[model samples]
Structures are given as C-alpha cells and as structure tokens.
Target chain A: MERPARTESPTIGELGESRTLARILPRLASGDAALLGAGDDAAVVAAADGRYVVTTDLLVHGPDFRLAWSTPFELGWKAAATNLTDVAAMGARPTALVVAIAAPPTTPAAVLEGIADGLHEGLAALAPGAGVVGGDLSASTVLTIAVTAFGDLEGRAPVLRSGARVGDVLAHAGARGDAARGLALLFAEGTDAAGEPDPERAAEVRARHPELVAAQLAPHPPVAAGVAAARAGATSMLDVSDGLARDARRIAEASGVGLDFDGEALGADLRVAFAGAEDHGLLATFPPGVEPPAPFEVVGRIVPAPGEVLIDGRGIDAEGWDPYSGWDGRSG
Target chain B: MERPARTESPTIGELGESRTLARILPRLASGDAALLGAGDDAAVVAAADGRYVVTTDLLVHGPDFRLAWSTPFELGWKAAATNLTDVAAMGARPTALVVAIAAPPTTPAAVLEGIADGLHEGLAALAPGAGVVGGDLSASTVLTIAVTAFGDLEGRAPVLRSGARVGDVLAHAGARGDAARGLALLFAEGTDAAGEPDPERAAEVRARHPELVAAQLAPHPPVAAGVAAARAGATSMLDVSDGLARDARRIAEASGVGLDFDGEALGADLRVAFAGAEDHGLLATFPPGVEPPAPFEVVGRIVPAPGEVLIDGRGIDAEGWDPYSGWDGRSG
Candidate 1:
C-alpha cells in the first residue's frame, strides 16, 4: 500500500490535538453498530440486547511490547485482539471499541496512521462489523494504549466462571503456546537498541516460523468459538490470557470444582501449554454427554474436588506470568 | 480521615496482580447500572435507552498531573470527573466507568485503596448512583490513568453540536476558570525530586488556598445540569474542556454559526474565562425564547456568520492547553 504523504505530515505537537484528531478520524471505519462515530465528545453505540458487555486492557510500551520488535500496526492489532477476546469470553458479539493513546510529542504522524491501519484491519478480520467508534489522545514519555471494548450478547445469558459443575468436560479452541515461543525466539536473537534485528536474519526466522511470529505480534483469537460454546450450553467460559493452567485454576476456584487434565486429550506439549501466556484461546466447560462444539478439543474434566488443577492425576505448579514480578528491569 | 495501616500493607510487587486485584475489587462500588462487575472476564452494564454513550480520556503522570499537588484519591476523582463530563456533554446520564492504571511495581497497595475510595466518592457526589464497574492494571515506568465512561440517554435524543440555530443563546454551568487558576498556584510552588513540595511551605499554601487546590486536584463537574439543559430544549451542547474560546470554536464550526460572547453577561475576568482549560463545565445553546436551565448562565449568542468565535465584537486567540506542547520534563 502506498503510504500517505509523509513530507508534510506534522508531529502531534505541531498540529495540536484537534487538528491531529481531524487527520485521524476519517481513517477509522465505523459500522452499523455505531449510532454516532468520532468527532463528537462521545460516541453512541446501539445496544440491541439492552445490555453491553464491556472490558478494558492497557498495553504499556516496555512491559507489553518493544518498539524495535513490533511495528505500530502490530501494536494496534495486538491491543485490539487482547480486549476483543475478553468480550468473546462472555459469549458476546463485539459492537465497538474506544482507544485512548498516550505518546511522546516527537512521535511521527505516520506511526499514528500505521496504528490506525492496524486497528482497522484487525477489526475487519477479527471482529467483523465492529469498528473504532471513539478515542482520546494525550502526551506521555512512553507510548501506551488503553482500549475498552463493548459487545452485545443478543439476549443470551452471559457465561460466568462460577457455573461449571462437577462431571462437566473442559474444552479449548485455538493455538496454545506459539506466542511464548515467538517471544523466546525474539529474545534469543538479540536486537539493536531500536529493537530491530538484522533484516536477513529476521526474514529467515519469519520464514522458518511465520505462525509463531504472528502469534506474538498479531494474535487471532477464536472469537466465533465462544458463541459456539455458549450455544452448546457451556456452563463456564473464559479466554486463556495468562496460561492454561493458571487460568483453569480461576474457573476451578470460582466453580468449586477441580479440573483434571488428560495428557492424551491435550494434544500439545505440556511444557508449552503450562507456561505460555497471551494465547487468547477459549476455555469452556460443558455438561456431561454434551458433545463439545466443533473446533474445541476435550482437554479435561471437572471433578468433585475444588480449587485444584491436575494433569495426569498429578498436581503441577500453576504459576504463570505476573506483571509486577516479571518486571524486566526496563521499567523504573 | 485516618490513613489505612501502612507497615503491613504490601506493595504491588510483593502481592502480585491476582492478589492485588483481590484486595482492590471489594473496595469498588458497583451500582444498579452494572449487571455484572469485577472478577469476570467482562462486565455487563444496563443500556436502558437502547443505546450507549461512550468516551475515554488518558491522563499521564507528568503532563496531565503532578503527585506533589494531588493525592491518589484526588487523581482518581479528577480522572472520573473528566470522562463523566464528556458523557454529560452528550446530554446523557452517566452509568458506569472502567479504569486502566499503569504504575511502577513499587506503588503501595494503600494508594490503590485510596484511589478506589476517591472513585466511589466522586461517583456518589457528582453522578449519584454511578460506579466503577471494571478495570485493568499494568506495570509501567510512571503512573498513568485511562478512564472510559458509559452513559444512557434515557430515550432522549442526543444533543449534537450541529443543531444550534442562528439566534440560539449559549449558556454554561459550573466554575469557568477555577481549575486553571488552581494549576497556576501549584506551578508557583516548587517541588523536589520525588514530586514533593517542602512540607511547611506546602501546608501553608494548602491552608491559604484550600478551594483553589481542591479545584485543581479534585474538580466537581456539574453533571446534572446536562440533563436539565436537554430537557430545556438545548440545541447544541459540549463540555468546555479546552478553554471557553477554543471549545466554542468547535461548536461554531460544527453548527456553522458564529458565536458572539456577551462580555457583560459572562460576569468574570475575560482572560481567565477565555484561556483556562480543564474547567469541565457544560456549554449548551438553546433556541431563542427558551429560558436557560437553572444554574446555566447566558454567556454568548449564536450569529449568522459561521466558524467565528468573537468576544465583545473582537476576534481573540483561542490557544489553550495542548498535552504534546506541555512536556514537563519530569516523565521518563
């Protein structure tokens, strides 16, 4: 795609907030769900079900992503995917997104445009018919993106974590450990201060493991499978954002049931599935004798014991990513 | 108010994300608007009007605020007020808020509790019955707060900026320049490396100018007046966030009519009224013969000429606060 003219593109400081917003507003795509779009103090979204399912997530520069490894487009796409998956976990159809971004004064206008492009593409591909309805921009030393997504359940009851009962089956959809492996690869192949790896080496890695790289940079959650599980009478459902075992413990504790994983049923490497976070796959529990929905693999079963997650009749450490404990020393 | 016990209080790093969330979740108050609150992947909020008004704002540590002048409680209050006012500008009743905060791991758990208290207090005092429904937390180099607010129109049509007629009267509610003046006073008082002003001097300033300090640290936007203006047949409306002159230009451009300020009717110092931003006061225009709503003062009139904002028959510069242009050198 031919890039917008960059010679005349001005920094946010040069054009100011209003003018910058004017430049970016036309690039956003608003769908039928938007009663009112950008350029207003507030955007209006149609709530067909008389209720809106809402979730928000924040992506800080150093902790969430390094500018060197990820482009502005990837950053935008990843941010949207993270929040939209949460809406999907509730068995809802995404309606709209509101993004709040803070960047340095020196940030290029082109970077903002790139981020918008990624947002537009992500919504079109991941949550069709949903768009960027509104946003706010401010100045900060490091770049940050805070996104809040809204969805409509279409009169269906929300699938809560506390609904799983003993004798239910646990299932999942989407890749398990690709994102973690991708991050490991990036760290092994050290980049420059700007986070850019050598072009030839980077291209080679991409060709060898394209899916892994994409998983880390631009995740594609199985959003449709959420509704499918709900239709299949899922008693409890959630997106696995912080590793399978750790997130499973959440459902187990909430539902007062133990999740016993069948090693053969998982069909993935235990090491990867237990430690990798940010896969954004759907994890759901369905009542006994109910066939799991298509694309969902039966990985485990709920037992009478509560608050325990076991694999092959043995308990393993459920520890996963903790933001504060995993402070990479880059942040203050 | 007695401060919470400090010695036993754990830092975010010590407690980790899940435990910290467990502590903070109970402190948040969710009103009837929230069908589902925290602990779930997503929150369900009532959108009784069949539509929802959504808006967001980002507040950075150094650019948007200073810890020297504002406590955690005040920061939370001001953040909620800023976004709630945007919902009010759409002539909607604020319903729920979702906050995303990013801070260093060393931040105290007590500070988080204080922020929650402030959010609860702000909602009860400003938009009664509204509450914080959900939120996200992350680790960052500096403290940042991003708030997204949702509101219900309650079957009333949204008052857009494009509706003002040639003979409409422009009115406003709440204090005009107090926040700006308060910010000026804080700048006058110097701070140390840790964003703390000298103890004795700070106490003296606080005692002498309590209202001014409060205005800057914890603004109380007149949220109720928005619904009243809509009921009184407001043609166009918005919140005065970027100074009276600058924000008026938005209404003038949108409505395609010039706004002529009535200097005598304003009943305030012209410079402060025209240049101060962050007042978060409601600015609405009503058709001729419509009595302005109670507590709304007639400050200007709509004229035949379009896209011009004049005061006392003279064009004045509408420059106001621009975050990108106001980097304070304290952030990373």
Candidate 2:
C-alpha cells in the first residue's frame, strides 16, 4: 500500500475511512477514566461516584467558527474545553469525552489528526486525567464537531443553578468575558475588508492579542474549581458561559433569588463584561460564614429580589450569545 | 411574547434559541435513570455498577441519510437506535443519551421537534428506560445529529468483541440485510429521473414496501438481546452496524479467531446479507453448551482460522458501508 510522505497531506477519500481512522486514532490518548477505549463495540468509563454528569455541545463551520480564523487544533480544543466546562459546572470532574466530527471528503486527514491532538492537549491542560474514549467520523460539507462529556462528582452532590440562597456570597473563578471580547476583536480586526475571516489578518490579530484570541479559541477553564467549590460548601453553581450577568440571571431565575455584582470585580469594561459570552468560568454562591475556594473572588451577593441580575443595584438584561438568532446567515 | 399557532411552522431563526428550545424540550422526555435532567448545566445519570458504557455516532444529511427518503423523526430515531445498540452490545442497559444537532437557520423548528419525538419514541421502543436527558442545538450548513449514549453494566463484566473463543456457537439477533435492500429499493424506485431523491416517489415506495423501508429508515435493533447474550455466557458480542462479514471480521481480528456463518440463516440473499449495513443487530458467540438468549437465532460457529470471516468455508471480504469513502458528495 502506497502512502503520502509525512510532509504531504491526503484527503480522507484518498486514504479511505479505515486508513483515515488509522492515521487519526493515535493522536487521541485515552484517559484513566476509560476502562475500555475506542475500537470496541463501545467504550467503558469509570463513574465511581455512582452518578455521572453528562452534557453535549456542537460546533459547526459557519455558525460556531470560521476555518480561516481557527486552526483545526483550536477547533478541537475549544470543543473539548466547552464541554468540560459544562461538566465542571455540575461540580464534577470530567472523566471522559466522546466526540464526533464531520467534514468534507476533500479535507486533509491530517486536519482531523490535528483536532485529535487539540482534544488531547486541551484535556491535559484543563482536566489532566480526562481523555477521549470514543468518537465517530463522517463526511459532510460543513466541518462539525460534537462533543459529549462525562464527569464524576466524587459522591458529592451536584451543584445546581437553583441552589442559591438570599444571603450567600457570589464568587467567580475564571475569565469574565475574555472569549467574547476576543471574538469581537476578531470580527473587528481579524477579517478581511470584505468582512470575511482572513487567515493572514486573523493570525496577525492573534499575535497582537494572544490572550483574548486564545481565550476565544483554546480556553483553559478552571476545571478543578467546580469540585473545590462543591467541597467548600457551594450552595449553587453554574458555568459562566453566556456572560457573567446573563448566566448569573439563570441562577437567579432558577433559585428564585436575585444577584448583584460589583462592576469593578468583573475584570473588564462594564459593558463588555455585562454583554460578553463564552467565558467558561465558575459562578458560585457560598454561605455567609463559609469562604469560597481559591480563585473564586467575591464578586457579588445574592439578593431577595427574585429573577433580577443587577450591577451595582441596576438591573440588566440577560444578553447571552445565541447562535440561532440569525447572525451571518451563512450556510457554507 | 406573540407566537405562531401550533399548526403553523416557523424557522429556527424566527423562533430564536430560547423559544425553539421551549418547543423542543417538551418532546424529549427524560427517563428514570436521570437523577437530574435537562435545564441544568448537565444531566446526572445513574451508573449503579460504578461503570458506564459510552459511545457516539454522527449522522449527516448526505452520506448517512436523505431527507427525501427519511423523515426528521426517522433520522432522530435511527441516530438514537444506533447509539443504543452500541451500549447494548457492551451488555449494558442504556440509561441516557446526550444529543447534539446542527442545522441551517432556515430549518423549520418542527423538524427538530419531530427529531426529539423520534428520539423519545425510539428509546421507548428499543431501550425503554433510556431517554434524552441533555442536548445541544447549533446552526450549520448541513443537518447533523450526534448522539452519545450512556449505559449501566449492573455489575456484569462488559461483553467485548475480543472475547470470542474457538468452538463458540455464533448467533445473531435482529434484521440481516433488510436495511440495505430497502435502501436499494429507495434509490431505484424512489428517485427522480436524474437520480436525485424525490419525496413523493420515496413516500410511494415506502408505502408499498413499508417493512423494508422501515428497516432502512427506522430500524428496530434487538437491543435487549445484547445483555441476554452476555448473561447467557456469550464469549463475545458486537452490534452489526456494518455488514455481517465486515463486522464479524472485527471480532475475528480482535479475538484472533475466525467466524463461519450459515447462509440460509441470514434471512436474505447471501450477497446482500454479507454486504449489508445498518441492520443494528447483535452478533454474538456463546460457549459450546450455552444457548443464546431469546430472539437470538443460531447463525454459525467460531473457527480457529485466524482473521478469516467465512460463509460456509468460503472467505468473504468485509464490505461494510463507509461514509468517508465518498458515496455521494452531497453537501446539503
């Protein structure tokens, strides 16, 4: 069987599904949680806690990302990072991930390998012991990645968004709005004059604003904080994905309580901080006497005004980033 | 909030993410295994034996299915059915599913609702206690559904494809080649003059060959048979997602053994049975004196010929369907 040189890339069609899978599987390392990894009827993962938390998220070529602005590695990393945050929000430690990717036949098989590498490295960075257990690959015009993550609560109660109480102190544990700001920066300066994403300009922008762009691309969520918060007696917790203000409101609505945040504690410009999304961080509430876990800086206080999310006593609308509200309307 | 009547269909963009989710959530009923279902950051599912089985499969619009031939309900049903089979093949009882779907904004919200209903009903029909506890919705150029299923082993050792031993009695449960034949029927009789899928013609063909088309579109995999095979002391088991010959080769290669199938028991033409894919049946091998569980009919026996998959002593090439090998390059 003849094959391409190490430097050269071949389309998946050229390599065939078996060959393509052979090329990509090595890049994904199995985690300790995986009792049985890929290449079986199904993978078996350990959930010693007896209760496993599960969540899923999807990333599409047009609506979720632009290929010109994201390396295949970043795409995979972001997918893994986002799903891990969801698990973390449940006060669980990520145990395993099952990913499914769809791309065109014309795509280089190496692109998938890169994504696999990203998934591996992202897991290493955010949740060291977690790894890819199983995955599926298919041919599609739009590049897509769907990640489902499982987590172990270590026999602790899962922190629900509805657990907040009126006297609890609200704290946060990661980037406030860096991801959303980075995305704004990309749309502003990373695109071509025609408003389409341009690889060259995006690279230049990333070089200039590495922190923001990296936050938007391959974020390192405080994956360990969820378990820590839960151990330290967190009354309620959730991932601050759709901006602090917006996500806080979810806790407020769910708990039948309100939350007030100090503007200075948001760590960014007030407007950007309030409206920003994609900051995969932990927003948790702790009882008055119990201190929050490290890195969870006190940012707010739970209030009796039900369903209200306030900044310095002023109410704010929940303006989370929503992909289905018809933004670019780009199909392919 | 003003909304359209129940009979009027609206695009996802028109209804927005929140509203769209509100409409779809009611259709996806949670199961008993879910301690905490959707609306939380992640769902909590029971893993009573402390070990869980996981697997994911992606279904795209083109290579996997054609909307002209399959309804949205069928698409969701097949996706859930396939993943559930993977779990069942592990000798585990499926507990929960986390689904991620991506589609264009122009897609009707009802399509997703139909898919949700399909997922719920599919679980009810196959694994009654398993349900969709969590899911993600995203926009994409192509319609894609990724389902990740979790299952409980109930303290039983997982049935792996690599456990087959020589002298084992090979068996199978569920359809053999009806899916492939039905697909052939669709492409031949349900297509327009140019070979493009025609909804009307596909509908007419389905009406005439309901069983065959249903096997192809919304298959009824003998999911429970997997656990039965395991409890009955089967040496190995796997779900027949690919053709019997091809999937049997997986067991042969993994277990370092060979398989011999009786042609007459395949319930279809020899060629089609050996080459057919998407049957979602259980292929298992029991110890010499053990009878396979109910619904599992005797099909063949294991042989000592390493890496050989034979039909009555004649070797057959593994001819399973490969989506990445490029079938029809359709994007949308």
User: What is the C-alpha DockQ of each candidate?
Assistant: 0.82, 0.82
lDDT of 1 at A26: 80
Cα error, candidate 1, residue B209 (Å): 1.4
Q: Candidate 2: deviation at residue A163, Å?
A: 0.8
The alpha-carbon root-mean-square deviation between model 2 and the true structure, to one decimal in Å, is: 3.2
Clashing pairs in 2: none
| TM-score of the second chain, cand. 1 | 0.94
Off by over 4 Å in 2: A1-7, B1-7
lDDT of 1 by residue, A280-301 (tens): 9989999999998887989989
Instruction: Kindly provide the TM-score of model 2 when superposed on the true structure, using C-alpha atoms.
Output: 0.96
Interface C-alpha RMSD per candidate, 1 decimal:
1.0, 0.9
